[model samples]
Target: MIEVKNVSMSFRISQDRIQSIKEYLVALIKGKLKYKDFWALRDVSFSVHPGEVLGIIGHNGAGKSTVLKVISGILKPTSGSVSVHGNIVPMLELGSGFDFDLTGRENIFLNGAILGYSRKFLNEKYDDIVAFSELGEFIEMPIRNYSSGMLMRLAFSIATVVNPEILIVDEILAVGDESFQRKSRQRMMELMSGGTTVLFVSHSLEQIREMCDRVLWLDHGQVKMIGEAQEVCDAYQI
Candidate 1:
């Protein structure tokens, strides 16, 4: 289960200073700062049960990604609390955990470790990851040499193979070709059938209708509606 209670987040911007002495004095005495307060999320609360597929829909800059970040524990809420049970695999930004200077094979180990997999676990699944990525010869090459699509493929493959209890996907399906997309969608279906909870964030309404059991519509960091996928999508269209 996952519960988000009255969560909100904000950021502070600091002014630039020229002199070191002046900077130190300002830091000590004045400490003048301005807050933009983007309010990526504000008093938003929701809950997801095990094996539930919850789709988040919103316009650009509607705090969709922010909610995912908060749920994934990558960003702390300025106010309120978010509690999640069981392990989570967040496929938010592709290649987020990779080292550009390292080879793709090396980055696989790094990413798998970040996902809490043991070396033995990764070793057993290494071939599956490489095969899914379809970057056979390129796997040994540095990730920096690979294209953006290749990087996304490698990252997505690693993240999904872990079979986390809670999966959070954010626009990662937009990567790769038609065949890869089909395979990915099939993999997601398999996970859902296995009773894994999924939180999906995507702009594709059709895909949401096909994959998600429920949908939440958000606007300006607030929930506009939450219910059946068809109903929320209809409301979102208007």
Candidate 2:
């Protein structure tokens, strides 16, 4: 289960765009520095039960992704609280734990380590990870030579191989070709069937309707709606 209660996050952004470090230092010393308070989220609250699938949807700059980051523990909320009751696997970005200089084979271990998997556990699952990625011979090549699609495939494979208790996905499904997207969706289905809690963020309302049991709609950092997937999606679409 996961709960986010009255969570708010704010950042102090420079009001004036300083061109260089020297300019910034001069502004600092001259007491002419200016900042603006930007609130990414405010008083957002929601809950997801174990084995539930919750989809988050919003327009650009609407704080949808920020909510996921807070739940994934990447960003701490400025106020309120978040509680997660299981091991979390967050697929927030491409190549998050990958080393471009390392071969795919090596980065598999590296990525697995970042996910808190033991060496023995990774060794046992290594073949499955490679096979899922379908990099084949390219697995021996440095990741820097791989395309964006290849990086996404590898990242998804590693993140899902161990069946994390809670999976946080943020528009990562939009990567790769149609075929890869289908495969990724099927894998997510399998994980969901196995009782994994899923928190998904996507602009694809159709995908959200198909995959989510519930949906949360955010607008300007506030909870605009939270209810059944179809109801929320239909309302949002209108």
Candidate 3:
């Protein structure tokens, strides 16, 4: 189960960066360049059952990704609370925990370790991960040489290797090709069928409607509506 109550996140963003030492001194003295607080999420509350698939949808800067980040424990909410039960696998960013200097094969073990998986467990899943990623020859090469799509494939393959109890996914499916997206969708369906709780954030409304059991529509960091997939998505489309 996952519960997010009155979750709000605020960030202090610098308005502008001084280009040179002179500019910095002038700005510092004049207070021309300052920071402003931007609230990404505000008073958003929701819950997900053990086997439910919840889809979060909105436009750019709508706080859709903020909700997932809070749930994944990547970003702390400025206010309110987020509680998640069971093991979680978050596919929020591709190449986030990766080392560009390390080979894909080495990073697999490294990533598995980060995820609290034993060497034995990673060993058992190594071949499958490589196969699924379809980066056979390149898996032995440094990750710095990999393309964005290739990186997404590897990340998705590793993140989904284990059937986690809770899965939090952002718009990572947008990076891969059509074939890989289809493959990833199939894997997600398998996980959902296994009764895993899923929190998905995507701009693709069609995909959200097709895969999600329930949908939460967010606008400007606020919960606009939350209900059945069709109804919420229908309203969001407007």
A best-first ranking of the candidates according to their TM-score comes to 2, 1, 3
Better of 2 and 3 by TM-score: 2
Where model 2 places Cα greater than 4 Å from the true spot, the runs are 17-25
TM-score for each candidate, following the candidate numbering: 0.88, 0.92, 0.87
RMSD of 2: 1.9
Q: What is the C-alpha RMSD of each candidate to the true structure, in Å?
A: 2.7, 1.9, 2.6
| Residue ranges of candidate 3 with Cα displaced over 4 Å | 17-35, 174-178
Question: Candidate 3 lDDT, tens digit per residue, 52-166?
Answer: 9999888899998878878888899999999988989877775567989999999998887887678998999999999999999999999999998898899888888888889
Question: What TM-score should be assigned to candidate 2?
Answer: 0.92
Error of 2 at 154 (Å): 1.8
Please write out the lDDT profile of model 2 over residues 1-238, one tens digit for every residue: 9989999999878878899999999999999899988999999999999999999999999998899889888899999999999999888875677889999999999988888788999999999999999889999999999998898899888888988889888877755689988898888779877888999999999889999999999999999999999999999999
lDDT per residue (tens digit) for residues 67-107 in model 1: 99999999999999999999998887767779999999999
Q: What TM-score should be assigned to candidate 3?
A: 0.87
